[model samples]
Target: MQKYLILLAGCPCTGKTYLVNQLQQQFKDSFVITPDEAKILYAESIGFNCKAEKEALEHKVWQFYYGVLQLYMDAGKRVIISEYPFSDKQKRQLSEFAEQYHYQVITIRLVADFDVIWQRRYQRDRSPERHLCHIMQHYHYGDTLENRNLADDLITKDQFYQVCQMRQYDQFVLGNLIQVDVTDFTKVDYSRLLNELKQIVKL
Candidate 1:
């Protein structure tokens, strides 16, 4: 099995974590690198509660994210799994990194029905994480919702980031399978995904 970076590109709340968990268990050698999770763990270890509103904390978390990513990528060889909403630019950067390290890229992009995703969010516990409504606005807010904010005198970082995420999701679709509905996501269904990947990746 050749070393590869499995990019879990999808909209938020599309079960990337669930997919990563299963992948890690199936392939023990795989290094699942989740930037957000890593940042959270680092914060907890340091007795800090990193909030998005805090620019300094956000920067620190990103520092850790990039630092950890470079650290893992520097390691000899392993399957690196990441659930990032990768834009075209980021994908290009990833390609360059893979070329530099002689590692292949096997992206396992996942997607879902919008309504289904919204329902799942309602079933989950309340938290500071993304809300279904926010995600919906982010994904589909290209001309309609974005125009309202873009017309404003000043564009907030939050608005800019939301637009970036939407573009990234669009780029992912152009590269990966067309909207594979994961509305009724299950381990059995995930098994099919794995099997197909095993064929392509030959890992």
Candidate 2:
């Protein structure tokens, strides 16, 4: 049987990295790919931070990651991709790619309270060359409670949350896709989550 692919998606500071690391400790054979790591590699190689140059470099970085993912899947290895797969477009593309390789793809979406996320983002440290701090600050400003009421009307927060919560393993068993919410992790029962995943993947 081909190895499975676990794709973790979430906003910045949502603990996707932590979860991936934990899972890797448990599953020694799994391969992991993280976009931030790719970005750092690309930045180091190409001297990132210049406006036009950084944009071009980032594009190349993602292209490289996509090719790397395909290479791993072709080798029949279990790969765990950690990134913010935020849109239907990305999900559809990844799903089609996995299907082409006959590899089962399991998507896990991590969610936390906005306040918790914002606080984490605020405390995160970034390299001097990376503008992530500024970017995150901007995101926090827009998503803050003071601005959320105004922003909430412009978007379907609950629907989006539900989508993230329900899109993981549940979607896969339906012969489609899978989404799980890691919100309330402190109270979450990991054993139940593991059992549900095993059933979905028939492990």
Candidate 3:
């Protein structure tokens, strides 16, 4: 099987994880590296006046993520990074990682209508202790309001969102990238994506 550094980048609730799972089932010798799913590990390490302890927990998650990344890379496993790539710095990090390992980068940028994603974001379960809780509620912890908008306009806007920004990819990466319009994923012809992937990474 061919080795691939597949980066599933997208906005919140854009189905990055769902796409990652789809790819894992489609291919062999594949492993997904997602630290977000490790929240269960953080659940036990947070709360009270233990801000320092919470920070430590977050650090450990990164350590665990990178450690697992090393193991999979060493084992020649096809790796998928299912994380939000919404910044130049974040996308560059994925590009650099692919370059450092001589692995061809296949960035599958998931996209959707701003309003669709915004609606989904608010409907999802967002506990106060979770990451980005402050940004989600637009209020600090233990704060409340009669009405709050859970959608973040800046992050949801494609023009400002780095991953969805086509010009940024032109500046940050040369090629071997494709966009998956997930606005209607269920009705999408996924075989088209597979054909496009063949053009770049030989997956």
Candidate 4:
């Protein structure tokens, strides 16, 4: 049987970790890999700030986690990887890996309002060694109104909306992807979301 790989891609403070924790609780047999855990493990090895250094460390971290994911998959286990799949390059790499392993990849993008995230970041207590402002400024993973224009020529408004929607929907009809807006989970019908996920995978 092929292993199931659910990749949770989202911005910080968007409840990715919360959802991951819930999933782990519900599915005790599944393996969960989170970037925050990786950062905590290798913080001393990789200095803070220094975009280049951070990028290198992130690459190493992802590679390590991906290897671990492959191990679980090889054992026919379900795995959940929670990370910010920001760039197109990273997504392509994941797609390639899935193709190579013949594993089913389900990507979930969690999103929230910028102001909400900003406030969340501000309220979050960080170690004295790390500055919250610096971290927030440096983390560039989401599609915002400012950068949306960068790719205006390549995609239509509707297509772009679909791309934004991909954050939630995962896969599109054209096999491109869908975006799910979880702005207010309290107002959203979570049962419908669960049903949608069930339809996609046997989980």
Best by TM-score: 2
Off by over 4 Å in 2: 79-81, 125-185
Cα deviation at 38, candidate 1, in Å, is: 2.9
lDDT of 4 at 61: 73
Q: What does the lDDT come to for candidate 2?
A: 0.57
TM-score of each: 0.66, 0.68, 0.66, 0.64
Q: In model 3, where do residues sit more than 4 Å from their true spots?
A: 45-56, 79-81, 126-175
Pairs of residues at least 3 apart in sequence or in different chains that clash in candidate 2: 167-178, 167-179, 168-178, 168-179, 169-178, 169-179, 171-177, 172-177
User: Candidate 1 on 1-203: residue-level lDDT in tens?
Assistant: 36677788765557778788888887788877666664445444442222332334446666676667667777845777777665674666567677766676776666666556555544442333432222221221122333332322233445544764667663473223423456676633777787776765656
Residues 1-203, model 4: lDDT tens digits: 64556766655555666667766665567777765566545544444445565666767777776677666656666554445534454567666666666667776666666556545544443333332223432332331333322322233335544554565323321122325566776765555655666676665
Estimate the overall C-alpha local distance difference test score of candidate 1.
Answer: 0.57
For candidate 3, list the clashing residue pairs, or say none. Answer: none
Winner by TM-score between candidate 3 and candidate 1: 1
**Deviation of model 4 at 155, angstroms:** 29
Model 1 worst lDDT run, 10 consecutive residues: 134-143
Candidate 4 residue 111 C-alpha distance from true site, Å: 2.5
In terms of lDDT, the poorest run of 10 residues in model 2 is: 133-142
The local distance difference test score of each candidate is 0.57, 0.57, 0.57, 0.54
Q: Count steric clashes of candidate 1.
A: 0
How big is the positional error of residue 86 in model 4, measured in Å on the Cα after superposition?
3.5
